[model samples]
Target: MNAIAFTDVSRSYGNVLAVDGLNLTVETGRTVALLGPNGAGKSTSINMLLGLIRPSGGRIELFGRPPEQAVARGEVGAMLQDGELIPELTVRELVDFVRGLYPEPLDLDAILQMADLTDLAGRRAGKLSGGQSQRVRFALAVAGAPRLLVLDEPTAAMDVESRQRFWAAMRDYAAGGRTVLFATHYLEEADENSDRVIVVARGRVVADGTAAQIKAKAGGHAVRFTLDGQSAAGLDALPGVSAVEVTGGTATLRTADPDATVAALYRGTSLEIRDLRLAGADLEDAFLALTREP
Candidate 1:
């Protein structure tokens, strides 16, 4: 069964539409990333999925049941962007308390180890660092050993080391055949961690595919080289070159066909090319291209 399904789902607040006819599905065991700019309705969609709010129209289902039913049965778990840990509680106390809420919870020790909180189990929630708190939140989210794990900016406020450790733990969790759906602004995380990426803009899905596919959808590779005082004239006429930018003796050619563009750059031009490099569009590039204002 699919882990999640949003069928023509939409949500609105007075005159503002947060999610507009959003339609998508996630298969079980897939690690999917939901990406979008601010005001793109990512949070709203998450809220609706968690039964925190009702959609204005359409339907949502988790494992062939309503979101609320799935959540009530402990089939879903989520770590939202905003939620506070009880300051008086220690890491162990907090995690243990949450795990107790579920019928068949993961072992307390396992939760701590998965979230890298074993070392801080005795630390008070208020005494922990920002990254530590985020870890604690993650531990609570997974305490139920849920079938679907939803995280919104799960690594926010975390340092580089913290981010690394978090992703490792997240991967470990997902390795168990659990479904993961995260919304993050960190494009590289989506590129490296997720099996699929769904980009939403203006309350709608603008792009959906693997990282490479989405990058290709943005349409082109970049061919860069130093001009070495050579004139950039007539470079745009080269095969497959769609856009050309020259700055400080460096030329960047955007082309749909990198092979032809590179060949033309080297053979067709008499200009001395230095530091030539060819690269495909990255996730960030694709994101920008996909989410640009209409």
Candidate 2:
């Protein structure tokens, strides 16, 4: 059974639609990454799942129950962006305070060590840096050792080292039959860490699949060639070519029909093709293509 499921969910404020009809599912024990630009309804979608706000339409279920039911049962761990932690309490104290709310919670010391906060145990949560504050929230999120973990922009403010540590800790935690749902705009993080990625744009799911699958769907085939005397106008007339971007001596032709484009290009130009290469599709390339205007 899916850990989280949304079917035709939509949220609107006045005349502005934040989340359009959307369907998504996160299986138990898989880390599903949600990718989108700013104000793309990522937060609104998450808010519905977290029970912070009611959806304007459609239905959502978590662990086969409604959002409030799942949350009321203490089966969820969520760390939304900018959620405040007590400013005066030390890291240790904050973790302890959050831990006291759960019946069978994880050990505070273990969580601290896993989060690499042992060194900063004495540091006040309020005085900590942005990265440090995020870490504190992460510690609290896992303190209950819940079944489902939800994180929004978890490593946005983290440094290289801290981001690596956080990913490792997250992997360890999710390995224990726990599901993870993360929303972020970081392409590398989504590509490298997520088991699956659901991309949202304009309040709708633009793409959904594994990193490679989604990239492939976004059309990764690029034909790189150099034309001796063929002008930019001639290149744009090529059959099956979607776009022609030229710089220096190279022209990168992005096309869905690579064979047709290559045939047309050869017919149009006599320039010796030097270093003609096909660039494989990558997540970043795919994301840009998907989010780009059609």
Candidate 3:
């Protein structure tokens, strides 16, 4: 069965539409990333899946059941961006409290080790730093031994090292055949960790596929080179070159065919090019290009 499914789902607040006719499905054991700029309805969609809010139109199903029913059975665990840890409770205490709410929770020691919180188990929740608190939240999310884990900006306040460790733990968790759906602005996170990426723009999904497929939606390859005193005025007119930008001695070209563009450049230009480089679009580049206002 699919882990999650949304059929023509939409949500609105008064005159503002947050999610518009979103149709998506996530198979069991898949790690998917929901990527979008601010106000792109990522949070709205997540909220609906969590049963925190009702969709204005269409339907949503979690593991072939209503979202609320699945959640009630401890099938889903979520770490939202805005919740706060209760004050005065120690890290271990907070985790224990949440674990008790579920029928079958993970072992306390294992949870602590997985979240890298064994050292801070006795630390007061309110006394922890932002990154540390985030880790505690992660621990709580997994305490229920849920089938579906949902994280919204899970590494927002974490440092580089913390982010890496957190993802490692997440990878381990998902390796057990659990489904993971995370919404993140970090393109590298989506690129490196997620098996699939769904790009939403203006309350709708614009692209959905593997990381490479999403990047391909933006265009082909980017060719960059530095050539002193060389003009790029005619480069844009080259076959396979879609756009060209020249700044001082540096020229950047967006090309549908990198080999053809490179051959045309060599055949037409005599100026010696320095620092020439060819690279395909990464998630960030594709995101900006695809979501740019037209």
lDDT of 2 by residue, 1-294 (tens): 899999999999999999999898888889989988788899899889999999999999999999999988888988899788888899999998888887778998899998889999999888899988888899999999889999988998899998998999999999899999999887668877888989899899998988766655676668887654556666666775667898886788876566667776667775566677776555566667888867
lDDT of 3 by residue, 12-109 (tens): 99999999999999999999999988898999999999999999999999999999999999999999988899979999999999999999999999
lDDT of 1 at 276: 92
- Per-model TM-score, in order, reads 0.89, 0.81, 0.88
TM-score of decoy 1: 0.89
Cα error, residue 251 of model 2, in Å, equals 6.8
Error of 1 at 50 (Å): 0.8
Q: Between 2 and 3, whose lDDT is larger?
A: 3
The ten-residue window of minimal lDDT in model 1 covers: 211-220
Where does model 2 exceed 4 Å of error?
220-288, 292-294
- Clashes in model 2: which pairs? none
Model 3 spans with C-alpha error above 4 angstroms: 228-240, 255-285, 292-294
Give the least accurate 10-residue stretch of model 2, judged by summed lDDT: 278-287
What is the Cα-based lDDT of residue 106 in candidate 1?
A: 97
Model 2 error, position 124 (Å): 1.0
Model 1 spans with C-alpha error above 4 angstroms: 219-222, 230-240, 255-274, 277-288, 292-294
Return whichever of 1 and 2 wins on TM-score.
1
lDDT per model vs. reference: 0.90, 0.85, 0.90
lDDT of 1: 0.90
Q: Kindly give the stretch of ten consecutive residues in candidate 3 with the minimal lDDT sum.
A: 212-221
